[model samples]
Target: MAIHRSDSGRAPDTRELAKLARSARQGDTEAFLELIESLKGALYRTARTILRNDEDCADALQDTIVGAYQAIRSLREPAHVQTWLYRILINACNTILQKRQRQSLPGTLPEPAADSPVYQDVELREAIDRLEEPLRLVVVLVYLEDMRIADAAAILGISEGAAKMRLKRSKAQLRSWLAPADMGRERSS
Candidate 1:
């Protein structure tokens, strides 16, 4: 059930997605619900990586879902529904982060037990949380969501070079955060 990068390098069926988007845009509630169900896990994971709080992530996702419903009509390219949803998710997470900042909330928080593996995976999750937002988003989109660099760049509304730069930084940060002690534990099992 791990959501890691796909090695096969095949693109998803954009035609079918476009049809769904068109239907949803035309006020088809079931189509919209189906779209949400298809993307919920990835959306939640992306929000969790950015917001780093279960409650905030959930709130952000809820906001994103609502926003998407309202904004779907404005979407020019139905074929790009996935990227469109990702853009909304990022915006939602950013909004939550800004609100939390105004309230002086901590930036990074631990994942819930249900969302993480046992004690052995705690260090790995901590390493991921240690990343800055830019790097973390790239990691989540590229690795966790199995998006290619070009596609991830499109989703994040950044240049491919920027995406690559962020990925490089994220990997380096993760390696540094893992270090010897953390790596030992992760590798021992």
Candidate 2:
């Protein structure tokens, strides 16, 4: 279901979202489903960015949904439902990563998801894949997801200043990786 965007086209009304959350907390299944439906795109992007594979992304999303439903009553701020959902998603992704780390060979990474919708550009995808977790997550939240630094920081449980620093560092790293090709193009031209 398409969320109803306001005239500004920013996000769905926070008041509406908060109402859904409050209803969901009170055992309204339809409201809970609606809330999840609205956030499905973002949840997928977040999981795909962190896990880098469809299977793990699916797992993380499932875990997040279940966890969020079970703990909906614990949510302190109804208006911050998006942030709360993202926090649960991030934790689910991290848990999957930790498990994968334990099972994988030393120094090896998980295979990239085939035909990933988000990272269609091969070069950019590889560069983002090479970034460390913190920087990579910041890039995903701030750049790919187009979230504010403060919002990204809240999801990542970091200070706003730290989120800004990570965004800067991620940009510099991406530029370093992508600049060589640009330089080659310029030289050829």
Candidate 3:
């Protein structure tokens, strides 16, 4: 299914994306380039949310684009391009994370640069980074990427209800973490 955003104007039209996907699947290189161009920002933002490092984000995006282009012909529905593309991206990011885990000796890698625009609010970014992968992914996909829960579920390979539940739990967790102790005591009194 084509992902419909609440703020439709921010994203390219679903019909146009599908048409591009169809042509790309038929081995039209220009169409594939256009499709990837249109989704590049969203793809980068999603990757940034997961990886937090610009270098890793770029690597993941490159890998995802190459992987998607190779597998386009196998995609059963053009309308599902966004979902399929994100699924590939998430997998690519995970692959990078796995490699990083194996290669790094705990403190070898530098901390995420605070100056990055994507991490404007350090506290919020740290809180998000602290979330478990599944919950963090749901939050990033639905909230950060402006994706519908159904679409997020499609990418995550989860039921819509499960995606919704994850989002709910993430919000609660974020709130508790962000909330002031004084605020909680005030509310109780």
Candidate 4:
């Protein structure tokens, strides 16, 4: 026999998630575990967008899980749990990125902008990797994750207007980078 969960290619029910959040906040381990399972795939993608390394993604995820478990009780609004968890994951990913920057010697070569395993468009991913963290993050959350603007902003801990502005900036950058004439100039200069 096979069991299908709401995670089987369907959006989870908000009410069900709210109830789970409430239970998790009340110190129910199983509920929190369930919540994590349902959200892990999206969370991992978000981490990948920032860190670009599987090992770093793993570390960020581990940190996020621990951090969330410890702080669940303080999540005041159960309905906002998904974005809350996302925020924690983003913070963890950023922490790992900062540590990597500090550990690397100044003369060491930067890692290549890898072709994203998750997206078929190699050039797009490369362009995205070239973008600053704020713009790249908004693109990944809003476009790659298929998340709404407001929710993406919430997860980024920014106002919705700021998220929109970053998204616009990213689009302009991608357009400029991908243009044929711009590419020639970029290669030459």
Task: Identify the runs in model 4 with alpha carbons over 4 angstroms from their true place.
Answer: 1-11, 113-115, 182-189
Candidate no. 1 TM-score = 0.79
**Candidate achieving the largest TM-score:** 2
Model 2: lDDT to the true structure: 0.85
Q: Arrange candidates by TM-score, highest first: which order?
A: 2, 3, 4, 1
Error of 4 at 116 (Å): 3.6
lDDT of 1 by residue, 1-189 (tens): 112223453334566667788988898887778777767777878887777678898899999999999998888888889899999888888888778778785775545424542114777776776777788788878886678899899988899999999999888888877778667689878
TM-score, every prediction: 0.79, 0.85, 0.84, 0.84
lDDT of 4: 0.84
Q: How far is 179's C-alpha from truth in model 3 (Å)?
A: 1.7
| Predicted structure 3, TM vs. truth | 0.84
Model 2 CA lDDT for position 141: 81
lDDT value, candidate 3, whole model: 0.85
Number of the top-ranking candidate, with lDDT as the measure:
2
Alpha carbon lDDT of each predicted model: 0.77, 0.85, 0.85, 0.84
